[model samples]
Target: MTATGAGQAYGIEALNVWCGLARLTAADLFAGRGLDPERLDNLMMSERSIGLPIEDPVTNAVNAARPLIEALPPEERARIELVVTSTESGVDYSKSLTSYVHKYLGLNRHCRLIEVKQACFGATAAVQTAVGYLASGISPGAKALVIATDVAVVDEKAEYSEPAAGHGAAAMLLSDRPRVLAMDLGAFGNYSYETLDSARPSPRFDIADVDRSLFAYLDCLKNAYADYAARVTDVDFTRDFDHLVMHTPFAGLVKAGHRKMMREQGVTGPRIDEDFARRVAPSLIYPGAVGNLCSGSVYLALASLLDSGVVTAPSRVGLFSYGSGCSSEFFSGIVDEQSAATVAEQGIGKRLEARARITFDEYLAVLEHNLECLVPVENRTVDPAEWEPLLDRVGDRPEILTFTGVKDYHRQYAWR
Candidate 1:
């Protein structure tokens, strides 16, 4: 199908997110951990998706992409020549996560399968890479699937990072049908440097320097946009785009980033507040509800904006993505009137509501096994029955991809 809006050719065709079936309210988490309640407002999170022992990055990727793949006609699905999985939660050193995802998704064997790692920015990088390939005439009328998947590894020891780190995946289809966001090809910018602001040094441990990460994030936001403005002409931070979306580690940082940008453009006082309300606030709802989705964060932000009922017209949108270790990009796209409704039809809100909310004690029960999900093992098995408390919450939902066990170092999975 030819995309009907925003100078179409290549962009997101369909989108979906899968966050497993468990969730925990940040307020409850704060209370249980003895974290100061007053500081909760700074993170602006309501709840976060919890990764259970039966769920991992692989399960997350497959679950997110299954619906999108299942919805396509045979011809369209067959044309999906690339599958790129971006993640910080890889299960193996040599075998890319895309291999397992590709197996479960049952894509055409002729397709290319790959994985990416640049921390939270990996998904954006995956999106751009897919776009580049589709745009390249190397394959005519082709399609690609990009999934940003991750699992939460932090606990109370990681402190605030524990609540802010969410688990799930965002899957998107890219083709000539730019019905969602018609990416402004070539109008992009980049910034990067070696910094240990945050790092997952092991499958079971995460180290973060709050001060360093904060400074790096804010610093990258400024330089990345500056690079974009330097490359693209006739752009105004305040006047050019109808909305703004950014990689939201926490919703408050988005507020801070937008405020910084507005100030750079001499947009002060009430105008900044007014502009933010109209453009940015709509994007924060999902991020706040789900915490940071890692590489999936920005896409969730986009979904929040589209489903927020603020999109009544085709409008330009500015997007920024930053990853720790650190890479950043500033880019944009256009979304027409049809985009919002298309997203709404996906029932994102309904799915979010369906997630089972568990208590702090239940969270504690699953914590140990959850972190062991990625540790390499030659022989191991995960009993779904052990995860019944969390799984029972979404038991009514049919056909969920699950991790069963491993045989001879190869991971095994099944649909429950």
Candidate 2:
């Protein structure tokens, strides 16, 4: 039987994040690389998720989602009729990452699996698509799994991008339950245009125009919010939304975006800071710790808010998602105490704290192989034992999905 009821409600029923097993403290990385100390404060980040050779998009997606899927009852699991994966770090041009993720997550065979690519905007697109699917009367009780997974490809040469880039996935279950976030359906704003702000020309590398990217991000936020204001009724940027979450490439950018919005509202002096401290600071906690989760940034921020213990009562959350080359949307959702309780149950903060903190040198050593995650290789293999020392540092060594190797131009994975 369909788990969804006739009473109309649909959005993210459950949500979880996996930012990998290790992190490099941003301050240490900056110091080791001889970067400016003031910039570290400007970045406003503590660590960046360190991608390992033993992990890839497949593993990350599986690990991020396994907990939710395994905890699902059989009938409910079967209701997971769709899986949409969003990524810019794709492993193959011909094959979608959803195949491996869906298989590894042990979802029902009868399911719709697809992938969406839009830089940081992909997650929102996938979430909206899933919500729409479930809201469609044809699939009255269906649930969709939306996963945004990626591997970091930056190094010291990437300058600031290196320290701000993160590797991982965020899994969201969309159904009529909407336990975590009850979306304000039909309330959304959009903006997009052709601009070479940033892109990955090859699986091996990425190119970006820092200035252009920054300007585009701010522009998108402003216009998108204006578009949203036009569409939604009685919208007050500072008053309507109890909290605000934006696609964060870095925590500092979010602060800047908030400032732009406040300035638009003629907000000045300490009230802007007061509003940010109250409505925006909670969402930055996770992004500051794990860097950017690419398309998952906004969702991670939402998770941060949920885990922030702020939703004592029902709260309205304004969400903004932007991707470069460049598309954006401003949307709204409702969160309650249940949202806080469910996200807290995931213990995201504790898990992040538990990651093995690697030094800059150690981070360098691992990047050589981790960077190969998206490369098209005919025959390659990875041994978990090769990285046991790092895992040893992990202490608990939870069994996460691991990338074994590639054989016959195909990727292989296992639990370890």
Candidate 3:
């Protein structure tokens, strides 16, 4: 189970991260929204969330990816063999988001483009797929670009759903040299089953049996961890991993899953609480502030932890990724020797700090604008020139990519 002799050639080279710039504090969202204030207060407690405009999903992918792509020496960028976009928030049905992203980024025309959809687990699949491709002997010096981006748009009017909804994106550059965590393909732990934990029959919003979804997530964690544990006996997970990063739809579920996982693994008592705080709490900071990014959530947690500069090479990080409807995996990777250099280059912290806090009213307005984009462009008699600027101003952050209104059935996006 150790990476030795496991042939871990395709490790992450670089990771770029970004989140929705518009902020919504949970307390402000429920202050006077025609609800039982006390109950809403108890539900969200004192948490804040962020949301992206409907168009921002693709924009997020591009904005997040541009940095890593630009940072690459031109020769490396030219040799990119594959570009894969993983998301639950795709702008077009007929054409993959990779098509737009590939063109916008001006990648080599010969590169292959693909899009993956499997709720939040899509990005993991993309990374694995890239690993498989490299294992198959791709062109020399070729690399793969895997981008996980998503926006959580729920029924803003529904109190239970709004608190868990948020948006963000992360882009990873996979190559032979490891700058970030070197993935161990051989030691993956996975669990999958058919269940109606969460689904979206229509494109507008997701409907979830929260209680069922939470149970499934924890159960999957237990099963996947057991599978992985059977192969690697040298380290007890609680005592080994420097950090445990879990997909966070909201913070409480992960905390609950942590306790359940410990009990299932036959570990107990005060040490469990202490281990959770030391190994798991650091990964939650960004997710706690940003809400859920669906496909981007798990990786975002890892990126946030590494961006802190506290974790270094040779440290093991346990990661659990869950995609509702529902697939989950428990995997682990070792931080690389060059992690400090990678973290120094990543702009995640700066982007997050630059984010603007907006009123609950502004959040609602952005929600309404996103809902409007859901309507088919063909159905509306709209002129792009008139509405483009208005939509571009949704999040109001300068220099980032934004999605403008559709023009003659083609979705429009640009850096503004």
- What RMSD does each model have against the real structure? 2.7, 3.1, 3.1
TM-score for model 1?
A: 0.97
Candidate 1 per-residue C-alpha lDDT over 64-178 given as tens digits, one digit per residue, 9 for 90 to 100: 8998899889989999999999999999999998999999998989899999999999999999989988888788899999999999888888998888988899999999887
lDDT score at residue 375, model 3, on the 0-100 scale: 50
TM-score of model number 3:
0.90
Per-model clash counts, in order, read 0, 0, 0
Error of 1 at 353 (Å): 0.4
Residue 328, candidate 2: alpha-carbon lDDT: 96
Q: Which ten residues in a row have the lowest lDDT in candidate 1?
A: 1-10
Q: Which candidate would rank higher by TM-score, 1 or 2?
A: 2
Candidate 3 lDDT over 42-160, as tens digits, reads: 33234444554534567788888888898888888987889999987766777888988898888999888989988878898788778767766746567999999876657644467
Model 2 spans > 4 angstroms off:
1-7
Native-referenced Cα lDDT, model 1: 0.89
What pairs collide in candidate 3? none
lDDT of 2 at 306: 95
Alpha carbon lDDT of residue 229, candidate 1? 83
- Angstrom error of the Cα, residue 247, model 3: value is 0.9
